[model samples]
Target: MKQFLIFVKKECLHIWRDRRTLVILIGMPIVQIILYGFALTNEVKNSRIAVFDQSKDDATRLITDRIAASRYFNLEKNLNSYKQIGESFREGIVRMVVVFPINFQDDLLHTNHAQIQLIADASDPNTANTLANYASAIVNDYQNALNNDQKLPYNIDVQLRMLYNPELKGAYNFVPGVMALVLMLICAMMTSISIVKEKEMGTMEVILVSPLKPFRIVLAKTVPYLLVSLLNIISILLLSVYALDVPIKGSIFLLMAESTLFTITSLSLGILISNFSRTQQSAMFTSMMSLFLPTLLFSGFLFPIENMPKALQIISNIVPAKWYYIIVKAVMIKGLGITAIWKETLILMGMTLLLLGISIRNFKIRLA
Candidate 1:
């Protein structure tokens, strides 16, 4: 136990002495979070929607049924009052709301015109735009049906109102993706390269000669990075909430706990990379190719995974960051609790254990 602690201390001291690396580890997440949060914008779909139907008339019911049946929207709530619209958006319950004013059918039948309002949480403008278009198309189809049956033309005007982020800032969408990307790259890339550095320096052989087992040595090497990653997580969250003006609607404790779990998962992946890599260059390239690209492509942030080909969508299930991104969005943006995210949490846990077990088994084999 003492020897293990000593190994851990030595690794910590070594990292402390490397000022540039320390700065990069601590500083890069902060920079990336701010940069990506402000600069990027993209589209998303398959969003939850709510309906505020003031008219229980047949026309309103038909319109609500059409919107709910569409693949692009899920009818999650039927709000009783106007006040629930803000509550739903703030709680992340629904992305878009469909409202039918009172006397909707009467207005359409007698006056030949009625209004339907589409209110969306425009924190992600592209999503809002797409949803509005999709919903409008559905309503338009209903109008077309009415036109075919009756002599007087029927018109249903779709009015749009954007809530939460009226300006449609990109930060609301990008911050969570940036968090997933930054942590996955920094923790995994740094860890793999650091372990490979020790191997290249021939210090690993000296450590193997110590009384500490090979697994302990590997754990010692990763401890500093795990600690650094926790710090990175804190910095990212602070910047996200303060600098980016993104709120953590869920429990902060749940977010940190999940972040820590993901950090361990990333560290385990790094350790696995170190096992195969003969040099720091190869380790870095491997981490970038394997961890970086997968996180970007499969994480469902920059691109919608549901939009991908069936095979690619299946492939995305294996990426840790994909799950982590979902978890962060649910916890940080949606203000959801563990009950909403337990499946993802369990998947991450299963992944961490599987990766750690493989890494340890390989580390033991290599040392022997």
Candidate 2:
């Protein structure tokens, strides 16, 4: 019995000595809980919306004030014309727009009926639907308050206009998100594991003695995976269009170019991971923990980023997948041109260069 107890103590000491194992056991759970607790919410709050109050009467003022006062919405802009609404959506300035028609209160008072137009950016159908519903409920509440148990009920019709995706197809949102998630995971995981496998098999030292520089070695190792990732990009685009019925509304060439850029960025990250990881298992585990969860959470694929806490939103800006996801959505779903997504494209390019530089530097140190 004493011998068995001593063996158990030795095993415990072994586990305690391995910092990576300790982190996976204790630190991962804490991080996962925090991310899930804050980011896994379905309730959309503080959604930015615009108002086009043409009526400018007492009733219109009251209803607009109520909407602006609600916890769910933050009135961001007061649009001047109908043209500004589309510009706001394309620029990502607002999610939903409330337009009170001309003589709105006059119609309500004289005919006991009025209409309020709700125009929403429906590239994300779920958020669009939720915002429209919330606005409609608020309008109904105003109607009831105005009626105040009168024999005749006042009616306010909420005319919902879903731009970009009139049918509210789920594929519009799902395809872009899946594109970002797949490319990020596949490129990062495969490249990391492939490079780490060489180190584990003791072949990397042999290769290091050859004439190729560290940068060339890193480039040669990653090129094949880059090609494989491009093939994946093509397959995903075909499937999204044919099977899922999601159209590539923008320039296919631009989309492919952007995808290639993001793939390179992900590969750079994988090479950096390989520098720190000694085995294929460690490479893979690090890829999943670092790439998978961040792609899902910070990429705005699963949840609305605008609804997250200020701290999480700031953290999300550092995630490369977040910008890629936004680019895909803008180009694929909304059919916006390069002009609309230039900032995001620049950001991805900067990340790729930065990560590639660091990974190559690490490779040189390892080779030495």
Please report the candidate that would top lDDT against the real structure: 1
**Model 1 pairs in collision:** none
lDDT of 2 by residue, 1-368 (tens): 45334433543454458667445434433343333334544567799999998889999889989999998899998988999999999999999999999999889999978899999999999889999999999998887778783544464555789988786655667667777877787678877886787777777787677666677667777765566567667766776677657788999999999999999999999999998988899999999999999988989888889999999999999899999999999998889999999999999999999999999887743543
Error of 1 at 105 (Å): 33
Q: Model 1 over residues 264-284: C-alpha lDDT tens digits?
A: 899999999988998899999
102: Cα error in model 1, Å: 39
Distance (Å) between predicted and true CA of 43, model 1? 9.6
What lDDT does the true structure give each of the candidates? 0.87, 0.81
Query: Could you estimate the TM-score for every candidate?
Result: 0.69, 0.60
Which residue pairs collide in model 2, if any? none
> What's the number of clashes in each of the models?
0, 0
